[model samples]
Target: MNAITHNTVPTYQRISVKPLAVHIGAEISGVDLSRPLASEEIAEIRAALLQWKVIFFRDQHLSHAQHVAFGKQFGDLTLGHPVFGYEPGHPEVYSVGRDRFKSRFDGARLVRPWTGWHTDVTAAINPPAASILRGVVIPPYGGDTQWTNLVAAYHGLSPALRAFVDTLQGEHKFTPPEGNKARQEFVSKVAATPLISHHPLVRVHPETGEKALYVSPSFLKNIVGLHPRESEQLLALLFEHVVRPEYTVRFKWEEGSLAFWDNRSTAHLAPVDIYDTEFERQLYRITLVGDVPVGPDGKPSVSIEGEPVAAHSVE
Candidate 1:
């Protein structure tokens, strides 16, 4: 496929949310998230998501059913929290709740402390393609989700670094980094599922055919054939590169707002600043199915682009 020369402008209708970008994301208005969407409208929404990596719908009054139905337009749904139970009659919906409250049943924490940059289910052999998250109760301040454009990050790499990373394989597992006793305990109590898988460092977008950096600091354990210290340093550098502010966008959440993001080409972090407070933040999330990852070189491996090149190298 030919490279996309200019970004595609989104065609909008009836909605109030303004378009945040031309190529990848939009904000829709004048619609209630609680209500059902028409077939044609759903099609338009899907198209927007495909071109833009994210789409935001604001001021929605979504019921569990409404949220699930909206997500179904994109693809098959996956169950949230392999261990924690779901809301009644809505098996696909995962409820995120605050940690301060004691519940009769098990529920995942929705507090700010849990916010970290990650893609949904990178540990899975086949991770989700997209995710739809609806804010239920939001904090007064200090909880926002930030997303990075991996495609742009990858394109900025030098050809030699790109080629080197294209051939390397990295391991992704559920183990929390050594140290941090509190987090380790939390992981054990959650009975968090551990997954081991391999993915290419550089991945080709199935639809757009653009290459993206696929590494995440949270899930990736090490690159194959590297020493522990070396792996840690290398992965840390790559993570910093992918998360540079210029390639990222931050979205502040509002009660009744919904954000849909493509897990394939983006990595996100939820900021956790509101700690030890009465304020509670909750969100409902749904993950969609994805295929096994493949690299730009047509290999079943991952790659990382190193430091920027000298100015002379460009000309």
Candidate 2:
């Protein structure tokens, strides 16, 4: 992997980037996120995000406002969630895992294999282009999050399959599981504010112009205009290919660790290992507003149910 040289970003002279995997993740050092960033520093960090898909930082414990401020450096921040709403005072901060007031039954309580994998809020017409997550409380031995590089996964497909998927579109919706005893409130909220989006199976990156497989099993319902059986078979095949070990990176979180990822070109899986155990995990996340996905054919995604997620207001 080519290092971000002084020529690339002048401020990167002090910043060091180390790749954690060949395709996806990198750890960045020599920059403190707790404070404000200069224009050149922001540019360097953005460049690293475009190249690595996901960048990690260790030992920078940020406050809720600090995290939101950091995310606003790149672009306008989206509300914590389209359906679930935001943390009390911080409209841009989304609290994950178990916390003092809320238990596991409140958020992402279900633990099925398919339910763990998703791109953040893809059910919206315009999904977030990027997401920043900071680790607050972490468990000891379990709870590792994994991210897969969709650009690499798309290229890994056979040429014929790539051509085929380039012409297809899929429907995504946040539907609650049937007969699940755990999250009844989650089900009620989803039913009240239904969201569904129709997006291309392959989306072209707005900034880099690269094509990525836009498959999020958790939200993607089916391919548009195809027979149910055919759609199911094809989606299952793509899902299996996207998470191959070679194109993915697993991250272990600590108290002050943070992960900033390009949501347009990746899918991530949250761990289920800490669910029933005695351990507790908590993380805070903020996302940047993204445009509607455009396919290689230059068609933009359409909203089927619900309004587009609005930008977060500090007021």
Candidate 3:
């Protein structure tokens, strides 16, 4: 693969957003999400995602089909969880509602915990490449999503820290039995379809060739070759480091808005702030398929805790 150079920045038209990145992310105006995008427009959006890693479009009146169509322009759509069905005719789209699920940290009884920082589907063998989230019904205040630039996060790490991480691997699972019983039971029913898998401590971006920290507080279980207590401490430290606010951007949602992010180079968290209200918050998400992960080294990456297989390494 060719090295990603600073000169490789792609072209994009900007919307009237307060902050503008050099090319990291942009808001596009003058386009309606409910309508079909022209070939050129879709091409530009795809290129922008490869270049910027995240894109936001506001005031989209998209139906399930329209949302799926937008996602398909970038790549093949991965079906939502086999067990959890999507809205009819939109198998790729998954619904998130506050009525059924609750955020784990905030004790918000209806919101889902995906608001925690994580890349989409990191526990899967082939994690999602990108995700498109459409805000259906947003609260008047207190629910926002924050995204961190993993490339920037990795670049900010001390060289010694990066070197140390390069030598390590982590176990990832939906939930572990060791956690709270209710949490474990919920995850086991909704998230525990498979055993744990291991991934490299560092991941190389598929398109950018930039290195990023890949572990998340939600799915990452333990480090290989370390005692349980030692692994927990180390993981806790790393998780805190990865979510530092310096490398992050927060986006407050509005009804009919959509946010698309590259899973390969970003980690995100949803905030659960609304509680004990009659308000209903809902969102729909579509995930695109991705290739196997690779590491910075030019060798195929192997998981540490389980059987190692020849796979595309992040290099």
TM-score for all models, in order of appearance = 0.79, 0.91, 0.81
lDDT of each: 0.68, 0.85, 0.67
**What is the overall TM-score of model 2 with all chains considered together?**
0.91
Give candidate 3's error at residue 278 in angstroms: 3.4
Writing each residue's lDDT as its tens digit, candidate 3 over 1-315 gives 111112232454532332335425667676666766776566566666665677888889788888887776667777664334566666677887775444222232322232267887676655677889999899898778888777777777899989988777777656522333344345545453553566777887767677878776667778877899989787877777777777777787898889988887888886656645767788899887766677666433443332221122223
Which residue pairs clash in candidate 3? 115-270, 294-313, 294-314, 295-313, 295-314, 295-315
Candidate that would win on TM-score: 2
Write the number of the candidate with greater lDDT, choosing between 2 and 3. Answer: 2
Candidate 2 — which residues are off by over 4 angstroms?
1-11, 99-115, 177-183
- Candidate 2 C-alpha lDDT tens digits along 1-315: 111121245435657889999999999998999898887777788888888999999998999989988888788888898778789988888888653324214333444344557898999998988899999999987889999999999999999999999999999997643223436666777777788999999999887889999999888889999999999899989988898899999999999999999999999998777857889899989888888899999999999998887787656
Candidate 1 per-residue lDDT, tens place, 1-315, comes to 111122233665644446574334568666655666775566556666666678788788688888887776667776664434456668778887665224322334333221256777676666677889999999988678788778887877788888877776688755433332334344653454445677877778776787888887677778888899988777777788887777777788899889988888888886556556778889998777666688867876332321111111111
Report the lDDT of model 1 for residue 41. 64
Score candidate 3 by TM-score against the native.
0.81
RMSD to the true structure for each prediction, in A, is 9.9, 4.2, 5.9
* Alpha-carbon runs more than 4 Å astray in model 3: 1-10, 13-25, 102-115, 176-180, 183-192, 299-315
